[model samples]
Target: MASDGESPVRLAAETWESLFRAQVAVMRKLQAGPAFKKVALNEYDVLFTLSRCPSGWLRLNELNDHVLLSQSSLSRLVERLEKRGLVARMAAPEDGRGVLLKLTDAGAELQKDIGREHVRDISGLLGPALTAAEQKELRRLTEKLRNSVGARH
Candidate 1:
């Protein structure tokens, strides 16, 4: 609700629908590529998250915040990666009760390999639809939304 006499801003119906449709369409295009042949998109999501961590590791709960999967599902995914030597799991040093997930050397290499192709795929799909300036603006707008959502927690 707006405070005092101020009014809250809202997206127009058409604008909202366009944004939603664009996102779904882009995601479909990105997920359809061969880059995810070796590892499923969900699995790649975990590996990619781990790759971004400076420590190359994160506690399970921490990882859960970054990925969309449920804890049980994430645990099972980690197991699959572990079985393939793509990730390693160990007890968190601070508290043995917590499990820490770390991307292995092989995992990092794999993420980097697939990530290169993924970047290319993204550019190829969006290159014609958005110009350099529009892409930058889109990124800025999306990040703003993401930060706003993250701020709630």
Candidate 2:
């Protein structure tokens, strides 16, 4: 037995949980795909961030913030990427103590390839379930949620 007020609260919580689970499932499946088999997700994230930056470079702290990784984890990942020739670290010109990470040409090419595959995967998985209008609505609603949550922090 439940009151009418409780119904809306239960419904909202259920909806949020379902949406979160679905998102996680989709991401897991995407990561398991062939295109991602060779690269860790964090590595891809770091590469993508550098690709978006001017000169394909960003400060070590900025990369950590953008990728939400611990400084030690980021340093290890950068070391691996450097070994693979996918990224390089250089001392910042203004501050010799500060370091910047830049994506190599190979990293840029890999990002482009993996990004295309990711887009294709998303389109294939979700495009049929959502009409164009619904997709737009979802984007708007998600952005609103992001903004509201960001404002709180």
Candidate 3:
């Protein structure tokens, strides 16, 4: 039901819409930047995720949780990256059925190279739009929103 006056449900929907739209706008600008030319954005995403792993050999399923792609699609992308020598995969010792993935040295170097340029692009897009403090607040708010939803699941 629609409310004539502002309602909690309406406010929630409006907030979500604003957040999603802002993400899309920022993503489009980042996608067009030169950093992605060397590596497709999704591929870079996978590499970036792996680059952040504290230790070696992140499980494929674990990696999937961190990235935007579906399991099947991520599997294919990993295969392509493996072929290009950008990522490596192995059978999980603890779980025979599980697969583990890691960035190869080449992949690490590439991710680092692209990351520098990508950060520059991101700074250019966000620096002017929000102050450092504002960015920190936005990060905190988004993390809160994400964690709240994640906790339910």
Candidate 4:
């Protein structure tokens, strides 16, 4: 039954469609860039997090949380990065049982390159569509939405 003549079915369908379209648009924009070709976004995120870490190292668990990846998935990603000589894992000095992930010089360089490419891609996609003030407003709204959703958890 509809409340106050409101069409719940139509509303829900429209919401889903909007979300799907937005995701596809954003993904298409990101995928058109050289960064996507050079490294999968998730891998780049992991590398960027490590690159920003103090001493270029983060505990395995800390890195996993930052990337929002499952332990198995992060382990697989780390393994691949290690094989590429972009990251290395070592036992934590304070706790030999804990592992620490650190970026290699190659990883650092890759992160820098990808960061630049990402900036260029984003600028190309939205630079003309929005003025600086509009961009600032969009960032503000995005943060508000993020915080609202985060509060629900």
Tens digit of lDDT per residue, candidate 4, span 1-153?
367676989876886698578768976879777787877888998999998887777999999878868999999999999999999899999998999999998999999999998988889877887899998997897788779888998
Q: Give me the runs in candidate 1 sitting further than 4 Å from their true place.
A: 1-16
Task: Record all residue pairs in model 2 with backbone atoms less than 3 Å apart, i.e. clashing.
Answer: none
Q: Any idea what lDDT model 3 has?
A: 0.95
Clashes of each: 0, 0, 0, 0
lDDT of 2 at 122: 84
In the predicted model 3, the residue pairs found to clash are none
Higher-lDDT candidate of 2 and 3? 3
lDDT of 1 by residue, 1-153 (tens): 355544444334555688899988988888889898898888999999999989777999999988889999999999999999999999988898999988989999999999999999999988998999999999999898789888998
> Higher-TM-score candidate among 3 and 4?
3
lDDT by residue for model 3 over 1-153, one digit each (tens)? 447677889888998899999999999999999999988999999999999998967999999999999999999999999999999999999899999999999999999999999999999999999999999999999999889999999
What order do you get sorting by TM-score, best first? Answer: 3, 1, 2, 4
Off by over 4 Å in 4: 1-20, 151-153
Q: Could you estimate the TM-score for every candidate?
A: 0.88, 0.86, 0.94, 0.79
Q: What are the lDDT scores of the predictions, listed in order?
A: 0.89, 0.88, 0.95, 0.86
What is candidate 2's lDDT per residue for 92-147, written digit by digit as tens? 99999899889888988998899888789889888998999999999999999889
Which prediction has more favorable lDDT, 1 or 2?
Answer: 1
| Candidate 4 whole-model C-alpha lDDT, 0 to 1 | 0.86
Model 1, position 21, has a per-residue lDDT of 99
